[model samples]
Target chain A: MRRFLKLVAIEWKLTNREFITIFFTLIFPILMLLLFGTMYGNEASEFMGGYGSVDVSTPGYINMIIAVTGIMSLPLTLAQYRERKILKRFMATPTKPIEILLSQFIVNILLTILGLVLLIVVGKIVFDLHFFGNFFEAIFTFFIILLSIFSIGLLIAGVSKNAKMATAIAYIVYFPMLFLSGATMPLQMMPQSIVNISKALPMTYGVTLFKGIWLGDHLIDYPLEIIILFSITLVFGGLAVKFFKWE
Target chain B: MNVIEVKNLIKKYKNFTAVDHISLEVEEGCIFGMLGPNGAGKTTTIECIIGLKNRDGGEVNVLGIDPNVDYKKLYNLIGVQLQETSYQDKIKVYEICELFTSMYENPVDYHILLDRFGLHDKAKSYLSQLSGGQRQKIAIILALISNPKLVFLDELTTGLDPKSRREMWDYIKELKNEGRTVFMTTHYMEEAAYLCDKICIINDGKIIALDTVDGVIDLADIDQVISFETEEDIVQLIEKEIKGINKIEKENKKLKIYSKREDLLTDLVIFLKEKSIKYRKIDINRPGLEDAFIKLTEKTRKVE
Candidate 1:
């Protein structure tokens, strides 16, 4: 346990030393939130109309967009670590693979929370938007969404041989989730075929669970969403752990 | 007792044997050297012994523990310095030392190690900023921090200049004084001659010679060469009349006589005087480790 901690500490220190990585990982997501939030303010109405029949003013759609954006940022952070060989060096030590993966999980979770806070803060201070329901429920749902998305990111990083390939794979996996999860376009407006396909995506379940709390509507019960999200987390997380290549 | 024992160790990569049926033993508290040229399977053997590579056949025991089954226990007892010591560019020397030391239960003091390597002032410097020799010193320090019972050093002084090479030799001697067993592989014959109590010369993934330094040198039956600049064709006379002379060659006004008897030198002097053939200069050269290495490897090649 002590050895694992030492490895984690060393990895953390090395990660911090890369000034550019810190800027992109921790600060760049906040920058993106501010830039995108400002550009789409009130204009989210026009963009919603092109998707066909959904109302732009729905609070659920707005909240899903904010939450899915935060989840997509997880992959960029992990790909940076893989590019630098920090994972390979740690594996050569006495540190177990599980501990190394856990440390990355903890770091990604903290960053996701930071990104969430930035989006919320920007949403309230700039756009005068407010979340609809119990604060604790919203926070707990957000946690599950972030965890599930990050596990997918972990799987991508573990399987990729290099950063360039990882970036390409992350984008290929992320764009469909963002576009189809009722984040940018309401699921009610999308064709039934697309909805049926998106239902298999973990992000779709996340967006549904998140939207439930955002609009205070019991569209899907919280317990069922939690169970589905947890299952997705376990399966992807196990595959990531099983196939992870330290080098 | 032997600290390391291997029997018929074999490693094959898709029908190509990298390490073939090699066997050797390293006694406790001795500087054992694995002398070989490049692509001689030295690194493969070391990796297999350390459990970094799997062996197709044979048994390996380090400190009475099987590395394949008990690597965790073996890891705690042995330290290794590979040819390349990789690290993050921004990590400072002291941080690396501390981090590697923390992996073991009982570790030597980091500061003291830095001082001993004359790297105390560079403790705060990053790895990218250090010289090659300094980086190598840091690697050695990291290897010894655990104060392991057995240490493996691969090409430990390959690129160092002469002065730094001598310093590293002294450091290895210090480790010997502290009762540590070191298994090292090197291409430098002089380094082996200076430090190794026992050496196994490996060629083509097999042990060609294994013995004390002097014993290996003595195994070659060829005698030394005595060369001199002479005005006469003394090579012809020496080849015909010298009783113990094995071979004689002459080129560019110089004569070389190879003899098995030591008294051949005295006889040659008397023979030259009788012929009134005064030589400009003469020198007698004895066979050294390099000569034995060439002879053994050449003989092995011929037998194959």
Candidate 2:
């Protein structure tokens, strides 16, 4: 247990030392909230389908931050570690190789939670964002979304030959997820064809579920979204475990 | 007593064999060296003994534990430095030491280790900020931090500078003085000759020679080279008249004699005096580890 805690602390320091993880997980999300909140204003606007711009877009931004951290930042680091034989180095020690993976998960999960808290704090202070729905349910859904997204990152890390390949593959998925999933641009403003396309994206479902729950929508209406997220989590998580290479 | 024993150990990768049926033993508190060319399966053999690779046949015992079956139990008793050395690039040096120190049942005080390796002042520097030699020192430090009874160092000084290499050699000597068993692999013959109590030479996945440094040199049977600059063609005379010469070759203006017999030099001088051959310079060069390694490996290749 002491060894595990030490590993977790070291992993935390390593992750924070990198600029990309910090920017995407902490800085970028807060910047998005402030930038979009000022432009769309806090007042209830018909432009965002009868909800205030800050209120409707806030969940999208939050989910976006989660996706960036979970998919891009976390997996790239692991792939790089493998490329550099850091995993192999740990395997030779008394420390089991699995402990390194567990520490990475713990550190990234903590960072994701920190990102969420920062977004909420900034939103509440600057935009007067109000919570109307069940608070616990939102938090639970956030965790599920995190699990779903992070599993995909694990899969990427497992199959990628190196960090460069991981980054390229991550960006290919990251940009589309951000722009099309109502995370950056409102899904309401997109064309019917683009909206139909966004429905196929897992990130879109995550953002929709979070937005619906945060604005007091009934949880029972998004059963399909929950099922999709859980299914992706299982499939990706299984594959990641099956293919992960220490060397 | 032997700390490690292997019998007919075989490792295959698909249709190719990486380690053939080979056997060796490492005694306690000895610096055992595995010397081989690049593709000779030295790393693979080490990997199998450390439980990083599986053998297809035969048996291996390290410190009375079966590495494949009892690796978890053995982990605390052994340390390993792989051929590739790396850690998290942004992690500070001391943090890496502290992290590794926490992994063992009983660890050496890494602070003292850092100071011992001359890395005390660079404790707060990121891995990226350190030079190649410094990074290699950290890898060595991490392996020793566990304070294991046995340590495996693969290609320990491959990328180190001359000064760092000497420092690493001194550290290995210190480890031996502390009554620890050290197993290492290297292509550097001088390193093996200088540091190893027993040296094993492997070629094409099979060990061709295993003995003390001088014992291997003796086993190669090419004891010395007798070279003399002569105006007359004396290769034919030396080959016919010399009693113990193994080979005689003429290169440019010099006659080179290779033989296992220690009296070959005396025999050559008598032959030269009898033939009235005048030589400008004569020299006798004793075979070292490098010569023994090449001869043994060549003999193996030829037999195959």
Candidate 3:
């Protein structure tokens, strides 16, 4: 346990020194939330009309965007660490690789929560938005969405060789999650073929669960969505552990 | 007893053999030097000994523990300083020493180690801000922080200036005085000759020569070198005049006459005076380690 804590402390120190971590992990996300949140404002609902047949002001669109952004955080951070050889150095230490991975996961979770808090603060102060519909359910769904997204990111970072390639591949996975998961547009209004494909994506269930919670829909009806999120987390997390390359 | 032992160890990267089936032993409390050229499998052998790489064949025992099976225990007892000093550029020297020291059960005093390396004043400075020699000093200090019974140093003074190189050598000797065994690899022949109690000279992943410094030098065969400056064709003259002159070569405007005869120098000086040859200078000296290394390796290559 002491070894694990020491490794975590080292990781923290390295993260603090990395300019990219300070920029993308902290500053970039906050700037993005503030900039995008205000630009869309009340028109966030109107922006949702472009994707599908669902009504724009159904409260589902806001929840979808938040979930998708939360998912994006995981890959961006993990890939950066892998590309910089931070994971490789950590592995060279006496600490177990699993401990290092756990520390990174915890740090990423905290960073995502901080970003979420900032987004909410800006949303409430400037855009007059509220996320207070069944706060416990909302928080539960948010945690699930964060875990699912983080798992995918871990998988990508572990498998990829370089940062640029990881970033490219992550975006290839990211754009579809945003566009087809009903984050940027409503999936219900889209063509049947597109909806079917998007439903298979991990982020799709997270967006659906978030919308269901926000709109006070029946949680029992979204069992498949919950199951899909949990399943994706397990599969991706397992693959990450098995195939992760430190160097 | 041997602190570390390897028998016919081999490591292959695909088709190319990095560490051939070579065997050697490191006695406790002795400074063992693995002397070789750049690609002579020194680092590969060191890595294999430290359990950082798996061997394809043969056996290795470090401190009575097989590295492959008992890596955790081996790591606890052994300290390794790789050729390269890699760390977070923003980390201070003190932090690096402290962090690495925490991994061991009994660590040396961090400040004292830093002071020994002359890095006490630069403790708070970031790694990027320090000079290459200073950074290397810090790396060495980090390696010693654990106070391991056996320490591995790979090319410990490769890129340092002359003064820094000598300083590092003194520090290594100090470690030896503290009764710690050091297994180091170096390309510098003088370093091995001066510091190593026993040296294993490796080439092309094979042990060409293994012995004490004086033992190797004694085996070189060639004894006296009679060097004299001359512009004329002295080779033909020496072949005709000097009876016991076995070999002759001209290097840098001086003719070198090699022989085992002790009185060859006196005879040559008399001959030069009697002949009235206006030579610039004359020198007579015995063979050194460099001569031995060249002669042994050169003969080995010819047989191959």
Candidate 4:
């Protein structure tokens, strides 16, 4: 257990130094928040149903951080380690290869939590964001959202043989979801065709579930969203485990 | 006692057999070397012994445990440095050392090991910040950090400069001196001759020769070579006149003669005097591991 903890700590330190992880997870979401908050202040807009524009997007921003770390950084790191034969070296030691995989999982989770906390703190300070949802409900949202999105990342990492393939797939999965998922823009404003496309994305449901809970709705308010998120987690996470490559 | 024992070990990749019915033993407290040309299955054999690859047939016993069945237990007793393995860019020297050290129940202080390689000052440096040789030293340091009973070093000094290569040779010898058996694979024949107490040459997924330095030299059954430079065309005359001349090569006033004759030197000197031909830079060369390796590999090819 101590060795595993050390692996996680070292993994965390390494993840924190990655330029892409630092940029997207730690800085990019906050940048988007400040930009959107400045453009559309906390005034209650009719489109948001008596809530401010920044308030509605704050929860969506949390999911955005998830996509960055889970889909973009996580898969690429794992694939690169395999390509470099670093995973094989670790296998020759007494330590189990599963420790390396689990360490990455824990480090990414910690990064997501860090990004979420920063967004919440920044939201409260800069835009005075409202939080009508209970903390118990918020904690529940945390695990399921990460499970659904990070599993997609894990699946990509499992199949992609190297960093190059992971990058290609990550972009293919990340960009469309980032723009059309209503995570970046309100779904009410987008055209019907774009909204239809967004429905195919897992992040779209993540945004909806988060957006629902953020606006003082109960966790049970969105059964479809919960069911979709939980199912994505199970299906994709199972595939990731089945097909993951060590070399 | 043998620290490692292999019985008809075989590994195949698809239709190609990488290791075929190979068997050898590594005795405790000695440096053992495995040498071959590229694509000779050296790496594959090492991978199988370390449990990185599942054997297609046969058994591998390392420190008295089957590597494929109980590799975790075997790993605790052996350390390995692979030919091509890398770490992440952000990891510091001591940090990775600490991570690897934590896995073992008893580990030597890596700082002292790093100092032995003259890398103590670079302990906090990131892997990306170090040069190739520095990183190579770190790879070796990581291998020895656990102070295991047996160590496996693949291509140990491949990327090091000549000076560092010599240093690593001494360090590897020091490992044997400290009663740890060292199993290494290297392309450098001189390295094999210098450090290995027992040398095994494998080619085409088979053990071509396994013997001591002089023993392998004898296995080649090749002739000692005598070469000299002379302005005159004496190749024909030497072949015709010399009774023991097996073959002769002539190029640009240089004559190279191969023969098993021990008295060829005396015969050649007397013949030069009788022929009234002058020769300069005459030298006799004894066979070394490189020559034996080539001859043995050629012998295997011819038999097949």
Q: Native-vs-model 2 lDDT?
A: 0.88
lDDT of 1 at A43: 41
- Cα miss at B129, model 3 (Å)? 2.4
Global lDDT of each model? 0.74, 0.88, 0.73, 0.91
Per-model TM-score, in order, reads: 0.79, 0.96, 0.82, 0.96
Which residue segments of model 4 deviate by more than 4 Å?
A: B231-242, B271-277, B302-304
User: A1-247, model 2: which lDDT tens digit per residue?
Assistant: 9889999998998888889788888989899899988887788877767778888888888889888888998789899989988888888766788888888988999988888889989999999987777988898888989999999999999999999999999998888999999988988789999999898888998999999998988669899999999999999999999998777
Compose the digit string of candidate 1's lDDT tens values, residues B79-188.
Answer: 77877546665888888887888777788898998999899999989987998888778878888887788888999999999988998999898888889999999888
Candidate 1 residue pairs that clash: none
- Number of the top-ranking candidate, with lDDT as the measure: 4
Tell me the DockQ of each model, to 2 decimals.
0.30, 0.80, 0.30, 0.87
- Which ten-residue region of model 1 chain B has the weakest summed lDDT? B80-89
TM-score of decoy 1: 0.79
Docking class of 2: medium
Give me the displacement of residue A50 in model 2, in angstroms. 2.3
Q: How accurate locally is residue B208 in candidate 1, as Cα lDDT from 0 to 100?
A: 87
DockQ pick, better of 2 and 3: 2
Per-model i-RMS: 3.3, 1.1, 3.3, 0.8
Better of 3 and 4 by lDDT: 4
Model 2, TM vs. native: 0.96
